[model samples]
Target: MRIEDKITTAFVLASGPFTDGSLWDAVSGRLGAAGAEVHAVTFSADPESHAGEVLRLIDSAAAPQVVLVGHDYGLHPLLAAARQRTGRVARIVHLDTAPPQDGDAPLALLPDPATQALLRDRPQALVPAPAPGEWARFGSTAGLTPEDLERLSALSEPCPGAVLTRPLRLTGALAAVPSSGILCTASGASIAGVQQLVSSGMPQFQALAEPSVGFFELATGHWPMLSCPEELTAALLLAAAGGGRRLTPAVTRPFHERPFVLDAAEAPRVRTGLVDLHLPAAEGPRPAVLLVHGGPLPRGLTPTPRDWPLYLGYARLLAGRGLVGAVLDHRLHGLSDYPTASEDLAEAVGLLRADPRVDPDRIALWFFSGAGLLLSPYLAAPAPWLRCVAATYPVLAPLPGWAGVDPAFDPAAALPMAGALPVVLTRAGLESPEIAATVAGFLDAADGCGAAVELVDAPHCRHGFDCSEPTEEARGAVRQAMEAVCAHLSGRVPIRD
Candidate 1:
């Protein structure tokens, strides 16, 4: 298909007072992440700023029904071109500017007398730095830290004067393409003004409210491209997605309030903690999965591929799929220290059960290897909120020299609880039948619980193999298990719609 026919490309036209197209660098990364093609253009002052080059670039760079994005002075001319190529323009996004007023002189028209006297003596303002710190002066710059600011400062360049001297006459363009304006607090006195102008009784164009073509104002200076790139990127993407809702950016903070402190009183003096939280979205409540990690916990282990970091990746995948998946370090390992870890798991389950964003009626427990033992007590007296349990290569039968560990560490004790809950068990090639037998014995004794067993042929498949080098079989196993859990929660057959 021709590029313009694709309808997925977005053209971000930039105005030149400053040739450095740094304004787009961060927002472009976000668009790329969200799977869109972006191109930046500069209409350097001269006749190029007036007309010809701008339309040509739009013709060459954009797809059919392009989302034409313009910043600063570029807004008016791009709108004019978009009007000319109405069929090719899907939406016109004006960042901190609006379409020109009727009777407003076009660039070809001499500088209007009203503005000429003022500009004749307009003192030259210093070229302001577009650094991160400079952007923080605006309220919209929240969530931006010094480092992000530093990155932007490095890419910024000086602005030119000629581009600023020109004013756009967009009356002709407004009659063609639909336009939406993203205005900043600094430049335009109010979004209401633009709305009023676009509303009724205006000399320019008819103010019929085009819901799709409107304005959104952020509490920031004239430059949102610099002050709040993340927010801007999010808003722009929403605009691109036909005005989708925005998600709050992830925050970095302590999982608990006590604050981290190390007490060298015990042999393994590392402090550990467990936390369960839900990320609420407007999409409605989603399934919540609880993660329990495997044996011989690594010292000070955070999420990395070497250990079962694959589960963390899986949780992210689940979250992306409109489900709420949580990962927690069990007691005696990870960030949670000793007795607290076990308490945390139970508390987390209880908490999720009470949460409105989580389907309190349908929580699934995902246990792998040694971590399977942590849920023994709960299995023994399974919570009303617990819907199903999946144990992959769980060490169900206590081996020799297993009694010295934590009481909650006894899967053998928890085995009886399996009778009341649905169970899924998986064994890989490297895992022996002895592992399966241990789990089977427990399930066999349970009155209502029969394990769904899946065994692989290879005798050497290591633990966490699915996570480390995922194959179709492994993915199938996880997907099947998830579907089973969802089915148990929903009280229906496990089938993907």
Candidate 2:
């Protein structure tokens, strides 16, 4: 089938002043010739808001299926738009650009030190076109002809520094969307981080390397559209037609048929209070685990669909292992304080225990980050149904502003009452001093109380290992930690060092 037949509208988003609509003429022309409606957009200052603008453009086009093609900084807005409009985006094409992960800044992704310096100096302002010598160092690397270089330089506008520095916020919305990358292999070899992404088997680059997110290489430099337009166009068409190789399958699961609803009246402030249960296709009640996510809340943010890739992946993993996995979205800091979150968790436990498919006697709790604070009360009065508790890079101490929410927020304080409930704690070696101190204090208290606590140290990793692109060391540590948790739930506690 033709690419145009698959996508009704295609938006070609050009990178800031580095290139413009004219630079994409060759590529867009080819797409247009293939019978797809193409719209090329360029933004002025305050590029952070460009995503919204692109959304407006897509809405204005009113096409059922849309394809977004982004180059350089253009990829940022494209990602933002794709995240917000996941259902509408048919496919995404990254032209000689590294797909930005959550919390990545465009400036940080640049492999060139010179480019970094140029961006840092112009904070909250506009960066003028590069000088002739600088252009030769940066622009000419794209394998553009002298005349093409002159035209690009003439069309270059002042790029917003804010756009380079602002972090991209992702909510795993694009995980299901098919994406393709046209890598400029020649220029990528010279870029500092690109080589690592291409060679070092980095975890962050796993999404790009995955089979669902297909990639093609071009012999040209950074601007494949300018240096190798025909090949770039072909790559885009292939991606649109779903004809690219993928390394790994997208992380998704088809489990139980419907969502088990929670009473919002019970916890009114909770966001979409629902427990998504994933159960293995089996005959009897199975061992179950409640997956709790962490959040202190970002100030003034509205609630959206909960889409933590880590918990989702873990839920699927647990279900595949013949256990029922329950994911709960508790109240956040701003929506409701610690008390509400704890109440919601209690309610989730009740729901799980009441479910016919879950083995109430063999339930476990897995906590991440701030949600670990909620474990304090549970430890203070250990429940028989709760077989074990697992925490990953948790926040054991209470936040200053949230002291009133839970007076017994300190995990150390509850250690003496923990009794014989086995606890597994995964600590990141490079964690910040505050968190390290909290973990240390908790361990000391646990030891003093004779609580059965197991420590799994990820010495080389920082916090959020599951979310990060995994190095070999990080991958091994995560796997070991997961195995320990699974074993604990299965009535076999692995001997700890």
Clashes of each: 15, 7
Tens digits of lDDT, candidate 1, 41-155? 6555363444556577667764444677776456656766676777777778877544444322222111123222233355232234345665433223444457656765665
Clashing pairs in 2: 203-469, 203-470, 204-469, 210-247, 211-246, 211-247, 211-248
Off by over 4 Å in 1: 1-273, 276-282, 303-308, 334-340, 432-437, 443-460, 491-497
lDDT of every predicted structure (CA atoms): 0.52, 0.67
Distance from true location, Cα of 413 in model 1, Å: 3.9
Cand. 2 TM to true fold: 0.47
Best of the candidates, TM-score: 2
The candidate 2 region of ten consecutive residues with least summed lDDT is 260-269
Global local distance difference test of model 2 = 0.67
